[model samples]
Target: MPASGSVSVQSLDQFLAEVEGRAFQIARIATGCDQDALDIVQESMISLVTSYSDKCESNWKPLFYRILQNRITDFHRRKTLTGKIFAWIGLKKADEEDIDLLEQIADPNADMPELALSKDRFSDALIHALEQLPARQQQTFLLRIWEGLSVKETAEAMQCGEGSVKTHLSRATQTLRAHLEPHYFSGDHHES
Candidate 1:
């Protein structure tokens, strides 16, 4: 291979290694389907390699995320449009299910205490509650709180306005608090 081609390959490999997990997480949140998420991530990887391999390394993360986000949004749009058409035609099956929200919530196993502690239990409960939020809200909350990104950065990654990011994060926090409040106040014993 030519030197330029070899360098591009190395850059693509490095970019994929660095961002694969994050890319998958973002795609999962956006698509809400594991298979779809995987497909989108793979597609994004290929797209990045094909289109942006020659770009500066510093520009890779946002560009990769932006491409993945667009793919995810496209999937949502197609799903919505299909659902609408099927519903209009009265051909939509009641049993047809989309993504399961509960499974999408971040597990607190990595952060939770092994010993039974109220605060630990509360945190786990909160994490599960966060999973129950809408996809966009969960994304915003995680990007802001867990990822520790500034509002502008989160907005840029999410391809949305800063105001929208703030709104989503606000709603996500409120939803999580409301869902966790009962368990938090009840002093219930959480088994380790």
Candidate 2:
């Protein structure tokens, strides 16, 4: 945990393990595809190890997130470019691949079915709400609030000013709260 020395292999492995789930979640929220998200997270982790492993463990969090953010951006750009090129060539994409993530993760190995079901639904709703956010807002909220990074660290990871990070987080929080409050807190569902 030195300020400048490279982390040991064990420490690096532990760090990757600790952040893997959240990283996957962040990438998933960004990509909206389970396989794409997994690829982005893996690429980000490898990029971090190859490029920034020489940095200190203390620096890894922000650096790894920055790499992740860049990778997500790159993924989107590539998708867009590929789509345009395909259209130009008169080639069309395959059928839509909308994945029901809830179904994909429904069978959690939890002993308490009631609690697990409720928690899973809420988590799913939260993720859906997150998907509705703008890119900057989503990244800011994930890095600053969900991932427990400081404002300064989030700013660094997002390549934005601290004020921008705060603004994005505020907007994202309000949007998510408005989206999820009624569904979770109301006494009755307002089914349309």
Report the lDDT tens digits of candidate 2 across residue range 61-97: 9999999999999998999999999999999988668
Question: Which lDDT tens digits does candidate 1 get at residues 41-140?
Answer: 8998999888987787766766776677678778888889988999999897564355543333444654665433665577568756765788789878
Winner by TM-score: 2
The backbone clash count of each candidate, in order, is: 1, 0
lDDT of 1 at 126: 70
Assess the local accuracy of residue 53 in candidate 1 as a C-alpha lDDT between 0 and 100: 78
Q: Which candidate achieves the best lDDT against the true structure?
A: 2
TM per prediction: 0.69, 0.84
Full-model lDDT, candidate 1: 0.74
Q: Which runs in model 2 stand beyond 4 Å of their true positions?
A: 1-4, 96-112, 188-192
Candidate 1 clashing pairs? Answer: 105-131
